[model samples]
Target: MPRHYVMCPPRHFAVDYAINPWMDPTVPVDPERAMRQWTELRDTYRRLGHQVEEVEPQPGLPDMVFAANSGTVVEGRVLGAKFATRERAAEAEHFRRWFLEHGFQDVTMPQETNEAEGDFAWTGRLLLAGTGFRTDPRAHAEAQEILGVPVISLRLVDPRYYHLDTALFVLSEADDEQPAQIAYYPDAFSPGSQRVLRRLFPDAVLADAADAECFGLNAVSDGRHVILPVEATALAEKVAARGYEPVFVDISELRKAGGGPKCCTMEIRK
Candidate 1:
């Protein structure tokens, strides 16, 4: 398993701006509680024997807490995020510099708008890219060329599942004995994309409506172990029965800004 470095923002973490549908400037976020919840998440990763490194957060970048959007890294090389929206454009530079300074090779900035791991994840051999949300389809083409991996584009349909990470869970990237396993919500995807998913992953775990609401697909999996939101009790039980050891982590505060475990943790492939 790859170890990840998560960025813990300073006390400045709050809903200063409404970038995503889940964000509402009127709602108040308790920074202290959010920080505590985030810290505990980091500690949970450490307890699982994964290395956790922190990036010093800037005061104004409240969204920096969702570190996985930083960029997509493959074998130490990176493709810096080019945000589709103006609100997050400033973050592209910050993420690029962090990768360069943290022993990762100088990353290539994509011409098309893409939100790094926020729209891209690995299925071991192929890169499963998401579109019709934060990422553009052109970005998918750019990613395939930049990363030299086959890119499978999945179109998202629902605004509630804004990011692919919110609608699909990559359970097991292809291994020797098994092909890649995924869990996803069909309703969140376009009919064609849902059909594509079924054709590709016949045994995919179809998430229930209740589980999707709790951000069940946004959970993080480290092969045998899965980190699920505390609200996803039913999904947790199902995952356990599937032979994965379910580790529960409460990230209610982070979800207010629209993120879960995978959003905070970006795997560094070495």
Candidate 2:
């Protein structure tokens, strides 16, 4: 099925400060390369019949390129983001304003510190929320109430996979024809959360440390084609075995700031 997505061009993308484990100020980032890779990803989505929308990049918000953190939109009702870090706090209002200006009437900016889709993954049936790093656990309940969906809280144990998008992604949403499927790195979660995941998605694709480190789990799926980082070869093979067409795109420049395909793409389900 075709999906709706929002992406931001990496016009001002840079690793000016270290936020995540993947970011290093000393490491050079090629903004030109990042733009090329981002454009390719956007074009790929367009070629696959997906609707792609763009948010104008702000001058000072370099991390705005990772638009997935903007918010979670479902059935035209948007739960706006509240960034855990002061650096990204301004981005929330920009995204909120975009939604309102773009015909989204039911937009709710949450009071709790939540990085929106950075820690929330909707599976059609429910929301898989992550905490213990960026987002606060309290935001899970707030999202559940605002979005009118069940929110399952998962705690992250590793710093590298701080956001849920870094460690897991929904491969296919639950529908009348099929149950939701996912791909995730088990080691990123706590033992209890890992157990919960195993119970819920027994058939999920599990990524090893190697692929997870490559930010392979930071993928975007349109219920068929899975777009991921080209460096995650092993995970790509596994996804392919499960009947998904793995589309590779190199976002190595963006990866310097800890983002990949899913990080740049925000699915807007309406």
lDDT of each: 0.83, 0.93
Give each model's clash number.
0, 0
TM-score of model number 1: 0.96
Regions of model 1 farther than 4 Å from truth: none
lDDT of 2: 0.93
Q: Write the per-residue lDDT of candidate 2 for residues 139-206, one digit (tens) a residue.
A: 99999999999999999999999999999999999999989999999999999999999999999999
Q: What TM-score would each prediction reach against the true structure?
A: 0.96, 0.99
